[model samples]
Target chain A: MSPPNALDSARAFVVDDEEAVRESIALLLRSVGIASRCFADARTFMADYHPDDPGCLVLDVRMPRMSGLELQDELNRRGWTLPLIFITGHGDVSMAVEAMQAGAFDFLQKPFKDDDLIRRVQKALEHDRAQRQQRRGLTELQHRYDSLTPREREIAERLVAGESNKVVAIDLGLSERTIELHRAHVMEKMVARGLAQLVQMILQLRGSSRGDR
Target chain B: MSIPPLAPDENPLPAPPAESARTNFASEDRLSALLDAAVDPIVLIDSAGRILRFSRAAERLFGYGSDEVLGRNVKLLMPQAYAQDHDQYIHRYQQTGTPRIIGIGREVTAQRKDGSTFPIDLSVGEFRSGAEQGFVGILRDISERKRQEQELLRSTAELRLIFDNAPTAMSITDIRGHILDANHACQVLLGYQRDDLLQRRYTDLTVDEDRAALVADFLSLNAVDDSFSREVRFRTPDGGVLYALLYAGVVCDIEQRSLLMIVGLIDRSALFAATREADELRDRLVHAGRLGMLGEMVSGIAHEVNQPLTAIANYANAGRRLLQNGLTDAAELVSILDKIGSQADRAGQVIRSLRSLTRKREQLRERLDCNALIEDVSRLMELDLRANGLRLQLKLSPALPPVHGDAVQIQQVVLNLIRNAAEAMQERRGDEFVRVTSSARARAVVEICVSDSGPGLSAEVEDRLFEPFLTTKAEGMGLGLSICKSIVSAHGGELLYRRGERGGAEFVLRLPTATE
Candidate 1:
């Protein structure tokens, strides 16, 4: 049985020049209880698409005014986050390779089974939601972490480095009791349950810095 | 006798003792007159190397007065380059007295007063007179004879050069049609050793079927004209047939009556190949054009069909899920819908791929990765490869950079190369392999090598492999490699071939990389 909250039931966009492909993909999305918008081509889709909405895009690889890949590049350039599923007629493996390398969610050849396409779209949507949530959590973490005073940051860094209150106090040229109060504030601000959790959060923040770049 | 009677001043009789002196004076006068009247330039030189007497002709020839030349050494008349050798030559001649370049007659260069040298025929005579011994040298200028000899040598050398290197095949035969001379080209063209063809009759070399016709043609031409021109086939020593246009003519050679035939080969094999290639390319272009037109016509049908296919699939899936939940009402409809949906989509996909392959837009030239293109085309042709029971071995270098080319077009070239290699090895007795490999070469070039275990190209066809529409296959149009060459050249690359290490024909394509 299909899950009720399967991302196939999420909002979606169908972008294509062919009328039948556009209408059919929209119908398919509706059958899965997903709200979808249809446009004739990339230009029409771009003109009407709302950045605030969280949805996946079903784009034709080849289009008249703008190609689907070029649209993906432009969206990326504008920092707009959306999962992309390419539907190709002449699906060369090279193009598929390139699309995946460029971070496309999935690529489906023409005349693909509706279930296969729907399943891929559903997977892409799920992935997109998880990424969005991760980004939100990261942003919230960064905001809270950035609000810490320099002294509190020093204490947090020292605690994460496995230094005791006495070592951190000596390193920062502060009192041991003052270091203890700052460590408590670091844990509270980062929403950690304990010193171990706080250290884990600090390590996670450092690890994510490498991945984001 | 009557003038002797005059007795005043002319006939005054002297005393008897003075009579001998008068006779001596008369003899000296006679000798001088004889030397002056000679036609050859004569010079009389004493043993001390002094010019005692020089005739009027000698004075004119040596550019000097008799008085000035009388006491000078002969060295004064020789130019500086010849002067150093004159003394040695004179000494040698004097010592040997064997007439090395003197005595009876000899040809040598003599220099006049102005320092210009001319060929001269000289004869030196040795004689002993009463109180001194002297040499009488007779000289004749022969500049014109020397010029004629030089001109003859130059023309002979030029003729020999032409005879050796002429591109047309030439054979010299005797009056009886026996081959007497075969140039290098003629030997190679007829596939015969020089010794084998020598003394062989021309009729023996002609194809047996055409010998009668050739003989008739030759005789008819000889009857009307001195030369005969006819197209005939010649049998090679190795049993191969070669087409040649033979032009034979009768000529009287110095030693024998001979016939010289200059054969010009029209080389129609390459031409016929090119023509076939052009025809095939035209067909392919027409096929592509028709495909494009057909695509436009069928796209509407394709869309209409795709819609129902998608609907059927969706309905079938929904029914399948519903039946999994223990609902049997929609189960029968599901299998029927699945079958229809699968077939419709399959048809739609075939149409889609066909249209895309032969789309209206011409292939655009750009920098592309050959490995990527090969992978794409191979995937598209996977079904064909499998159906043919062929295996494709790809050895692509991972770090291969992009080569300057049209990706789609080069993919077509690679496809043709691989397909031809596979087809060539279709019925090979042993293990068959169609190996495709790519490597970077010369720092800025990429090479794609395609080799197969097919029967290698014949020496004959290998030379004209890229000529259009020449195929060994029964159903081939033969435009594959010709179009491939055009594509390669359009991208500033070269396609080449040879017999593979594994006993098959190998084709290698070299393309310039983007940086190159």
Candidate 2:
């Protein structure tokens, strides 16, 4: 097989104690040109999992030793951000709700249709991709934001808080031209094309940080 | 009996008829002493039945002094009825010169001085005292002996009553197996008359297969030892068979020698008929229980069978996708086909188990591995448990002793209980699992334990779980545990339950282990 590329490498790790079920899910994913790996149980999947893997997890909610819910909690404690798609049984509505509330991407009941499960897995993978891209973007923003001097950083915070350059000059007891110069430097260091762009980037950082919390 | 003669040779008088006057008088005094010393009361009466003489013994016996009764009429010593008849009899005897009771003894009731009457042995004799013809009487009280004789008669009558009316058949047979005497019940049991039974031998009443055993049992009792009990079929006169339990032993005589074999027969034909009827009813109940369980598990079973269908469809879909894309790895297509075939087989297996549960059939015993049976039921219940969010775990011991039982009935019991556990935990939230395990309890017993991780049972529920019409759930009819217990008990096993370690209900069934 050829080496995995950026898009091809994105996989769905299907973990279920039931062999036939897990294998059927993997095959379903493969039918849609999505690469997938199957694990007999949560423990084996945990041993093989990497935080940087570009994928989602299709996990059976209930298992003998370590259940999928428990594995989800463990992965969360280890700071892994892979989107989780759970496979629950018929009478497991409450468990599904709990899993979703715990930040799982979604859940599918057993004996679910092939397309149903495939669609859920696809959505979960898309969510995982979006999250990874956002994390990268946030890291780059943090690097640039950390490069600003204290005066420029203060002016940038005021501008993003809806204070114009003249208002920031009044609040900080500086000349309007000086405040404008500091705001220009802040915009250049933070890599924003305009005043609105700078404010929107800061808003995204706040939103992302709140999501982690 | 002969009466005592008054003028006999032992009168204590002088030997010679012509004795000296003084000696004759002395002889008379000695004769009086001898008469006074007699244990029997003696009295002399005239021809008119007048009292003439009374001895000291008579005074003590009559409760009167000799002086007080010297001239009293002899009628005073008899009851009113006898007193009236006595004087007439004595007058007739004197006139006719025909002695009545002169030398004969008879038992008569005499009145004492205090008016109490007692039975006595009475004898009277005639004697000539200086041309005065009179009578001497002697009497002995015999009340105690008479009362004892009456008691013996009453006891014999009571025995006859019991022997005639007892429900159980009974007979007395000689050591050689001859029927000596039989009660009415025995006649009814054998459908024959008492005379007919007496004419036949004990073995003649027994079935052909048991006749020899009957003779052997008779001879066995010849040792004059303990009684023996046996179940045998007796052949009645009309040729019908009578099932009976016989308790027989030797009846010894007063000399401590074996005289006869007394046999008691308990007729059990009615009980046999009733048991067969009950067995038929139980079989119907077992079928009904299976149907009920199927009703409860229908949706889950459908889902289980539907799984394989779903898998087969998915495999076909994937195979189609591959072929349309011109990526036909022929080997991959073949493998997918094989998987589809296996899935069909899996669904077929589920249907087969369902058919067994639904069919009405007779019970049969077979030697089976307990582990294999556990695995079979576990598979049957897997989809149902999955639907209810309950996990199924099987911990079957590999080398467990084989059990001889009806496979379908046993499977019904296991599946019913597991489903019951599912319903019990339906309301609870958490990791719910039903774990079934088989192990050896002892050399003679094997136990199957079904435990669940739901709310444990309360004492009242545990006590009533096996009772008909008892249920903790609104939809439950409560026949599951009752039928399970019946099936287990019919196999000589016990079904019991208790609170488990994981705060859930645990049911344990113990069946007698059979040797392979």
Evaluate all candidate structures by whole-model CA lDDT and list the values in order: 0.69, 0.77
What tens digits encode model 2's per-residue C-alpha lDDT throughout A1-213?
A: 223355546899988876777787777677777789999899999899888888999998888799989999998889898989988774677899999999999888766877787788778877888888888899899788889998888888888888877888898999999998888788888889999999888888778779779
TM-score of 2: 0.48
TM-score of chain B of 1: 0.41
Clashing pairs in 2: none
Docking class of 2: incorrect
Candidate 2 wrong stretches, greater than 4 Å = A1-10, A13-33, A37-107, A113-116, A119-213, B1-26, B44-53, B63-106, B112-116, B123-137, B162-202, B223-225, B237-239, B254-262, B285-305, B308-516
Candidate 1 local Cα displacement, residue A122, angstroms: 1.8
